[model samples]
Target: MNSAVTSRTLARTDSVRPFKAGAYGFVLLGIGHLALSAAAATATQTSERRAVDTVMRESTFALLGLERTVLDVFNGMSIAMAFFSITCGLLILAAVRHAPALVQRRTAFGWCALAVSLAVLVVSVLLLPPPPIVVLTVTSCAFGLSLRRATTVSAHAAEAA
Candidate 1:
């Protein structure tokens, strides 16, 4: 009898096309985040140094090695945030694939991960310059909304019977 109910639940879940699409979307977003992050880590350091050089060219503290200090500090933070973003994306992808029940119950986890990614990107706009704002924002918001809808459907299904 329990097995029958479980089968019924799975059948109902199968009809949720959005959930499947959202899972795929999360996977793609995760891959994009990882790839872009790697690109930034490898190629952008010189650009970042150039920007710092431009900004500090007129400042007196150029004599105190302030430009190099700023570059080091901000570069370290940017690298750390990039790694964190990639890890969060990967976690979302993994959870959607291997742990749907956990995803449903702890929907906040997914939301928080997306939110953090958005927040970091938004900050990067000012500090790092020309980060992929639109892609990250849209993908994060869409994935978060889809995950929320999935959990809601699951809840409604449970309450209906």
Candidate 2:
């Protein structure tokens, strides 16, 4: 409540804002991805066998080759998305560990990076055409927004100082 203590607290808060936002974003993104993977696995295991059999019976390999190619493209996209998500997660971890200090300095940059990363992730998930991936993308967007808000608050506080 004292001026000195208040100032110190504000300063500290500002310093860690971005890092905390990044961390939260990463955690959310990771959880979303894991959830998506689990759901996809479950759907594939439970519902796809009959459909796959039907497709196999009716479809020739040459025709199926196109399906395979499409799937291959999706697989590559999924892999890339996963990699980017992981990288974002790592950055979040770094931010969390360092907190306000890391956040204060790179708030804008961090936000931009997360926004782009999330955009790419969403596109990748859409390309895969998985319900779970879509869910993950939505959840990740929510988290990313939350982080952005937090960083903004922290930046404002810092500027006030």
Predicted model with the maximum TM-score? 1
Candidate 1 matches the true fold with a TM-score of 0.51
Task: Assess the local accuracy of residue 128 in candidate 1 as a C-alpha lDDT between 0 and 100.
Answer: 50
Candidate 1 local lDDT, residue 140: 57
Collision pairs in model 1? none
* lDDT tens readout by residue for model 1, 12-79: 33322333344444445446656775786577468667677566553443445554445455555556
User: How close is every model to the real structure, measured as TM-score?
Assistant: 0.51, 0.45
Candidate 2: pairs in clash: 15-100, 15-101, 16-99, 16-100
